[model samples]
Target: MRLPVRIALLLILFFCADLCFSYVQKELRPQTALQERDIPNALHPLVKQNAELLQTAALKKGITVVITEGFRSIEEQNELYRQGRSKKGNIVTYAKGGESYHNYGLAIDFALQKKDGSLIWDMTYDGNQNGRPDWLEVVSIAKTLGFDWGGDWRNFKDYPHLQMIPG
Candidate 1:
């Protein structure tokens, strides 16, 4: 084959491989069962459904949950990592893109709020005895809705985080 023609063919093959690589990276995870649909603001379906149900249940106990964060993009995660890598600001959260379930749209961070919308985030998970029990009932509601609460993580209980197992 002529050198020029061979080079052109090789360039085409390289471009196709690059495109395929990008696609794979974008879809590395299995299909998002509940994330791709059902959420009010682009939430994963299962996550949103269960979250709403849990929110409803919490209402019965006079607890209101405010979804503080949800569905972070890789770029957002990267930015967050930079901001949180330090111990300052009480270390709000610790997650990096592809490391956090949020990348798959299966996670959300929530906080209990009062009638006036003041955050009531329980600080007891970190041994702060002054925290309130407002979010405990929210946990019960989430369990009934089939969500795995990050609050139950043994090593690091995230009192304000809720997650999905995704059937």
Candidate 2:
């Protein structure tokens, strides 16, 4: 093949390879639909069902509540508890293993998002005056579905936390 012809073919082949790679990446990429893993470890079986119901209800309300964390093993619970107690940061979780409602599957952590995958999670309650407006927008929606808002806790207030009372 002539030098120019060979180079032209190479460029075309390179472009085709790139195109195929892009396509494959798009197809192989994990389906990040809802964060199923966000469900906390402490949820009770009935609470889990309540959470599922709330998830669907939130979708109908126009906010996408994604489960970002879920079920915890005793080991995971212990580690988390330890981290909270000894860590340099402020104390967080009070429940350890059997103490945590997570052991019973009664709690869940959820986030809101637009269609483009922009997460709406707040580490603290009403993080700012304008902070986590996204999270607050739907907290009530979850309550409407019968879940208690951790934000209301007189002590250990967790704005992002929600729990359901088994009906």
Candidate 3:
């Protein structure tokens, strides 16, 4: 083979290998589950605004809150719905695919994080030593910010869930 042609072929192979590696790396990147990236920017403007307010107000009251679930993809929602139904663990949700506000970027689920970086979903937990439950304090602040706490629902009590009402 000619030296120039051989060099060109080697460069082409290197480029193809680089592209393949990039694709695989993206596919293998771990999905964000209970983190800030789970919250999509497509959420209703009010929901996003109130979520910020809830976080800030909770912080003022010595409670640390983090949004764990938001703007769920249809596949993610189906997997959650399958839990405790066709899959193992407790039934987390009754909504499927397009059924929940999360599918429309209108809802969020929260958890309290301790100073040690441990996340807690216990509604009655008061890790701040303030005598009041951190979960309730978070929810109270959320309500004031115009978010409806799922804990107030009669049928299913999702202590961490909050959604904004459409005007």
Instruction: Give me the runs in candidate 3 sitting further than 4 Å from their true place.
Output: 1-41
Worst 10 residues of 3 by lDDT: 30-39
Model 3, residue 119: distance off in Å is: 0.3
- Mark the 10 consecutive residues where model 2 has the least summed lDDT: 28-37
Model 1 over residues 37-145: C-alpha lDDT tens digits?
4433356788878777777787766677788887877777767777746534455556665566676678888887766667767643322123545566667677788
Q: Per-candidate TM vs. native?
A: 0.64, 0.59, 0.72
Alpha-carbon shift of residue 1 in model 3 (angstroms): 99
Error of 1 at 113 (Å): 1.5
Each candidate: what lDDT? 0.69, 0.66, 0.80
Clash pairs for candidate 3: none
lDDT (10s digit) by residue, model 3, range 13-76: 9999999999887644422222233335477778888888888888888888898887878788
TM-score of 1: 0.64
Clashing pairs in 1: 34-44, 34-45, 34-46, 35-44, 35-45
Report the lDDT tens digits of candidate 2 across residue range 1-167.
89999999999999999999998876443222112334444556776777787777766656577776656666777778787467665666876765554555666777766667777665443422444564765776678777778788767887667765454
Global CA lDDT of candidate 3, please? 0.80
Off by over 4 Å in 1: 1-41, 86-90, 123-132
